[model samples]
Target: GTPDAEEPTVTAWGLEGSSLRPGQPSPALEDWEEASEWTSWFNVDHPGGDGDFESLAAIRFYYGPARVCPRPLALEARTTDWALPSDVGERVHLNPTRVFWCLNREQPRGRSCSNYHVRFRCPLEATWGSWGPWGPCSGSCGPGRRLRRRRCPSPAGDACPGRPSEAQKCVRPRCPGCGPNTCGCPDHILLGSVVTPSGHPLPGARVSLRDWPGTVATSDAHGTFRMPGVCASSRANVSAQMDGFSAGMAQAQANSSMSAVATVVLNKLEKPYLVKHPESRVREAGQNVTFCCKASGTPMPKKYSWFHNGTLLDRRTHRYGAHLELHGLRPDQAGTYHCKAWNDAGAVRSGTARLTVLAPGQPACDPRPQEHLIKLPDDCGQPGRGPTYLDVGLCPDTLCPSPAGSSPRCGDAGSRCCSVSRLESRKVHCSGYTLPVKIVAECGCQKCLPLRGLIRGRVVAADSSEPLRFARILLGREPIGFTSYQGDFTLEVAPSTQRLVMTFVDPSGQFVDTVRVLPFDPRGAGVYHEVKAMRKKAPIILDARQSNTISLGEMGEEAPLAAGIIPPGAFRSADGQPYTGAVEAQV
Candidate 1:
């Protein structure tokens, strides 16, 4: 019979190309114990309803290795109305709970399908209403409880299928100094302080208990006033008033014998003064940062503002709830920051809090799990090995201007040179970059000069072939020392074989001559070279390509100077007589 005309017999079908074909019923359908074997690709067929009903029209099945294939299962009727006969096949009530295959398939072996398409109509699902507001906390402190509830829509029989409400424990943060069992102490002292908005003490200010009238007390020079034997098992309020200042009141609950320090700040018609200021912070580039400012002034300072790098912050960009919160901080957000508390009297600025943001690859510090010292990585840079210092700068290849552009040179292009003065095995503390990395014994920039090698040699005269003693030896125009009696000297030179200029100065600090020496071999820890000195003459220049040949007379002109000539006063004798041309002058 057509599905639209009468109750057509319902049968299990094998899935094919876009159609369902009659197939043998599951072999385990009669024997319930074997049902597990067919549960993968087989589901019991049920009778159809007469009128239109709600059901899943199509379902996609995924199976095989890595869920490769996707097959869609769809339901179709013989007629357009999709009407089913009232007298369909006998229906079984074995699954009274109406459990159907909802993508729950067991993997089968030996060419058997691991997943099968499912297309059928059952009944409309029951929908639940919106959840209610959470209930109040069960306790004031410690672990508390709260709950929210929801219900199924009307017309749903009996009760909802799942839980009607959800419950969870609410945690209450413990107040500082309010230990377990101490918060309820009945015996407590009533003490407080009177201060200006700036937190400065106001001595001789009158303070009186609010709950118990006439219980007056006068503040000491320290601004502290105490009232002993006062009952504060629950709460108490105290007021302070002084001349030329507005009155102020404070409230507190006595939790301990050491009553919480209640501060009553009296307002004055003057500029605001900060009582609390934000602190310097070092945090990740993308993180939330907050700053707090507390101040007091006349009219209670109604307006609050924040500034970054001396520029006022837009109110819409940052959140203010008793403190300033910068959401999702970036590198640009790092700078010196402060807050302002203002009113009709005047505005007061708080102490600046510096925020540092480190670029990638820079040394970073991560908090220690259970310790006060921060843990750093191994590559954060090393500590000082000795008192020696070196400067490093990034540069182009053309830096230092060598005759032959062959060696690497550091110039003042893009580098931050910082001195590492801390002793060996000590931590490296940088002011702007406070984030601690691995504390190494040797500290320096990422790229630095290699360890220097000692260059030992003797300087001798070229013509006489004799050792030149008491002569000054220089490395690259810098005088290292004067030659000893043996004419032997040792100098430290940085690694790398490069052209270097060494100048020799006579003992009289005159007659200086410069010579170009061949590059030293850096393969060894120390190098030995014998320098041949020549008499003072025209300057000598060396070409790196022909370094072996020293071309003299490159320096053109040498002007004459009357140096070493005694002045007129020194020529006169002690008698103040300019005696000359006579016999001898100390011969």
Candidate 2:
């Protein structure tokens, strides 16, 4: 054959060329040609006996004079084995009548020779495989689909008999309430509708409940949705959301059947600001006080904090509504108070307010008076000075010493002011000096009188200032009189050359004190001479007259002589009534 010539037509015959089979020839090749000189390709009719042609053995084709034919070309026929072309893709249709021609050119003993033959085998039967494990259900709660799959053996069976994977309805157990076993769950229903502001139904809105978080219902064309099998008497939250609207919520308690409806609307955002600021106040000490702060905003304030003097107060201690309350208020708690209100937009501070705590007992008063006025008169000498004769400065005998080289007074330092008759110490006051000093008989004074006169006086216990009621009084060796309930006693003695002794015994028969009145009183009228007594257990004398202040309730700081000096019809009471008689006289 010429180079690149088309393949020749092929015909098949029975053994020994006995007879030509019907349609034994294949379609003639048109543009196809041999790939190379040593190889060629051709199609065969059936070479096996059956018309189905299960196998092929040999291929014989008449060729032109060979340029290099093998020396011993074998004529034996067997199945031909060819290297399948890599470029031939999978699942391709193979021609039953085609044959592979593989030729080899080799020289043995200096002769180039080649041998070839064609062969065929019966197509292997396809083996089917067992089914695989079932796949997961396509749906969780309803009738759904599952699939199982298998595959025919690779390379040997290129085609499968049927579908590789088969799908069927999943065999799931009945649901608690919605399925065949309705008694497994409570028979409850949830029904609701979503709507616009105008009450028109809004379709395709999503409604969900917290109790069934994983489940949701979509509104139908009528904006109505229904869910069954919810637990009875349980609480749940229902919410609705859609595009171009804010989410709306409604609380639902599941019963035999629950019906909840909600409408959603959104508004523009706003910032928080104060509406009413807190006010200041003054309260009496130990009283309770309260303050309030109110505000306005789009979303209400979520929290509040109270402040005292610009410091944040503990939230747990006060009540809400921005209310700051203080109980048992005291002077120490007086300070500036304010409140802070907070919301999603921001926080705002209120105007500062003040809290003043007034003191107890006294009417709110000012500080003490500064200007001096003529002091009020009293039996205690002067109102401001206190209640005793020594405070009024009545000691006339003790005078200031004369200038150097001048005459000296009776109570002067070197003058004989004290005699043996006036033996005890005495306090001497000088003209130019403010303080006085004690002097004894050892200090000489030219003229010092003896303390010789009658003694009559009231007696009182110095520490308590209470009267030593019914006490025994003694003069020398004789008992004079017992002190009355008023702690008063009187005694008289002949002018004594020796110092006179005065003694007292308490009503309880307790020995009180003994004192020489001669040293205390020079003229000794003893009218203003009040005597003090001491307990014998500790026999120390304490002068009751040394105390400067005495308390008189309604007559506070008023002189006892003022009661007698009032003119007729000139008196007035505290309420400004005219000419009042004495209280006992009026009664």
Evaluated with TM-score, which candidate comes out highest?
2
C-alpha lDDT (0 to 100) for residue 223 of candidate 1: 81
Per-residue error at 545 for model 1, in Å? 99
Which portions of model 2 show Cα errors greater than 4 Å? Answer: 1-175, 178-207, 214-237, 240-247, 251-262, 265-270, 319-321, 361-587
Tens-digit lDDT track for model 1 on 1-587? 12333323232232211222443222322343211122122222232333222122111111111111122222222112222211222111111111122111221222112122233222333667899999997767544678999988757363556888998756564333433332333345677778876677788888875533343688887788876544454355678878778778987566565554467888766666665677565445555556667766665666788877886665654546337876555786778988889866678777787776655444432211111244343434465432322222222211111111222222212222222322223344443454323332332322223456667787777766677788877665357788778778777664432345577666743234637564555534777778776656543332222213323343336543322233332333322244343222110
* RMSD values, in order shown: 32.1, 51.5
Which whole-number lDDT from 0 to 100 does residue 328 have in model 2? 72
How good is model 2 by TM-score? Answer: 0.25
State TM-scores per candidate.
Answer: 0.21, 0.25
For 389-505, candidate 2 gives per-residue lDDT tens digits of 332111223312112232222122232221222223444333333334332222222343444556567888765667888877765445778988888766553322234557777
Top lDDT model: 1
Q: Which ten residues in a row have the lowest lDDT in candidate 1?
A: 90-99
